[model samples]
Target: MGRQEKVTTSLAGTVGEEIGAFLAPVDAALERDYPGDPGTRQPVHTVYVPGDVFGAGTVRSWGDRALAALDEHAPDAAAFAAVLGLDGALAEAVYARVRTKLEREPVEDLRVDFEDGYGSRPDAEEDAAAARAARLIAQAYEDGTAAPYMGIRMKCLEAAVRDRGIRTLDVFLSGLAEAGGLPDGLVLTLPKVTYPEQVTAMVRLLEAFEKARGLAPGRIGFEIQIETSQAVLAADGTATVARLIRAAEGRATGLHYGTFDYSACLGVSAAHQASDHPAADHAKAVMQVAAAGTGVRLSDGSTNVLPVGPTGQVHDAWRLHYGLTRRALARAYYQGWDMHPGHLPTRYAAVFAFYREGFERTAARLARYVHRVGGDVMDEPATAKALSGHLLRGLDCGALDLAEVTGATGLTRAELDGLATPRRGGGAT
Candidate 1:
């Protein structure tokens, strides 16, 4: 008998009874199969402007002046559109004006300006301020025509906000809920996440808010900014990340690599270092490995330094800035923040390169694995040893166009199918 028949006959008696019982439940599951159609994948780049960008202070003033200048210089909608289209030198000028205005406001003022003076909701004014802040955030979403995935960096939940008690957490979440339904796929940037319990507390608060709103449980998501030494130095960094992921459970969507905070944690003195500093890269690798296949996106923190001057090789400066940005993107992380419009192209290019390379590499490896192994299993350890070479070869070549690679390599559909299937051994067959 052939191998298939031999195996079937060996299981024909007692095993057949177990198989029949298993098949009985199988039909019920098959009948209710809800094989949903695959949805289109959205583009991954998200440009973040500080939430304070539109509050009633220097940021708001700068925005008003910039808008007025745009109106005066380019009155028509087309001119307005042209200004929006500005990048490199022209874009830098507009961004600088806005940045200057935003920087003028003391960080203390911005923090205190939040409704209710941190934790205490003394009266109606605080409530009104909270409502206004929420409205401004919503309006910014509408005005900027921001990417579908938007997030805000809020003041940390702390002793001041907590009133030296746990009630502060509830008050802040309540304020957010009262302001509006959680922003689309909310990402609360929790600064100074030192312990797992802190993450758990935030999750509990989000859960309470969702239940009260009658929203689906776990609808809100969060991303932690890993800025503290304690966060990075936790016993088994991987375990720490895994713990954070579990705390948010269904709600955690991303983990942002906080370069500046991390450097400070390490006591690095150099101020001009970029996000890709060797030390930062090592920390990010830990995050990337932990987050792999979790469906939780990873983002590198922003390039803190912005280019100065309105003219003279501004594009070159932007390119250099982008080169750092691209390195982050190439590392297989999905998102990064753009502090200015000039950084937009770099973000886009890096994203395009990542997807293009990842798809091509996966495809090519599958193609070659099928060619070598055919439909049979490699049983001998010695025979199985060199099979990894095929995968490494494809990865080494970087990205390629799927159609072109398939055509050039002459791999057939049946072989491709075998390659796609997992083998008994861990590596692709």
Candidate 2:
């Protein structure tokens, strides 16, 4: 044959250059605003305690109380499993892991409440509580007893409490600076945000705090609590959540659903207020889409029905809470709220069970995809990233052991992460 063509092309070189030039800004925006997940270890749940009740040993106390609840109600793996309908074979493994998780790390994330939980207080009292919260959290971190993430949820940015909210945040961060240094995991929750401007105001306030404290720019980040209809949909009929995220200017860590507040706002009856309520689902569904590819995480709201009272009553509540948690996990809302210490056991149980149940299948698929081996179901790059991500989340939350995943997949943690992150060339993608 005559000399085979060494190269194949359709468009002229100038056409390609012109096209690239035209799309350069679009690429810049994608890289800047939609950089994807930060590959960080996200906590499984957030525990909100009133500012006055939070102390240096609150985390440990919660763990002890949760363990005590288990001892009192469900004395064994079989008993505990019966309440939640866990598989007979998987019950022991899930129960043991839950106990171990409770003993080792009961609360992964904590938020000292100053809004609804703490309620409106006198300025002096609120300021003192805010300052004390900082001191106690600082000591916890110093003593190596702090949760992985801890922060405060100041009052809303409404016109009435705007100044007070700003003051509390300043006092808190300023106190942290005095007490040594702020922890890297320090976060804030802005509650009852009704408009994107409120989010922008939070960004401005953080910028001011950074300048005042001589901290690096953008050092503070906050979660926007979606509790109002206006926050989900604007008067103009636009999805306001997407705009709210943009207003954060790269400082929104998560969009947390406020179950009760949001439900009540939608005129849902008190008895029907729940995270799984249709109203709540619609709100969070909007949030999920708005946050996708924006590096912003989504947190489902909590159930007000706590696990407490007599054994029978506690069992009912546990079943409800556990079922709700499991359902939320199936929908991909990994993080949630824990309102009571009794809720801790079931929360961990649901999470561990979800991950452990799928561990083998996910590992097999990920391995096959990585090795380019034939399989009954063809896997794609996106699916590979998701499979690897599931394993990583499990590993992060102590649901699955590193060695166990490694054994199943024949891949190390770093290799798994490489597979989870897409690259333009010569990588997982």
Candidate that scores best on lDDT: 2
Local error of candidate 1 at residue 30 (angstroms): 22
Model 1 — which ten-residue stretch has the worst lDDT?
34-43
Write candidate 2's Cα lDDT for 1-429 as tens digits.
898878977987799889989999998888777878878888999999998898888999999999999999998999999999999988999999999989999999999999999888889999999999999999989989999999999998999988999999999999999999889989899999998999999999999989988899988899999999999999999999999999999999999999998888989999999988889889999999999888899999898888889999999999999999999999889999999999999999999999999888899998898889888889888899889999999999999999999999999999988877666443333
lDDT of 1 by residue, 1-429 (tens): 455543334445778788879897875543323111111122243344442333534334433443443334444434322433433433443343333332331110111123112434454544454455555545544564323343444445555544322333344445556665566633455655767787887787777777887888868767676766666557664457666765665566667776676787788776755677787887778777666545565777777555334533333444565577657655755456555444443343333344343444444444344456443343333232222222222222222333554664455433433343323344422
All models, RMSD in angstroms? 11.4, 1.7
How many Å off is the CA of 189 in candidate 2? 0.4
Report the poorest 10 consecutive residues by lDDT, candidate 2: 420-429
| CA lDDT of every candidate | 0.49, 0.92
Residue 180, candidate 1: how far off, in angstroms? 6.9
Tell me the TM-score of each prediction against the true structure: 0.58, 0.97
Count of backbone collisions in candidate 1: 0
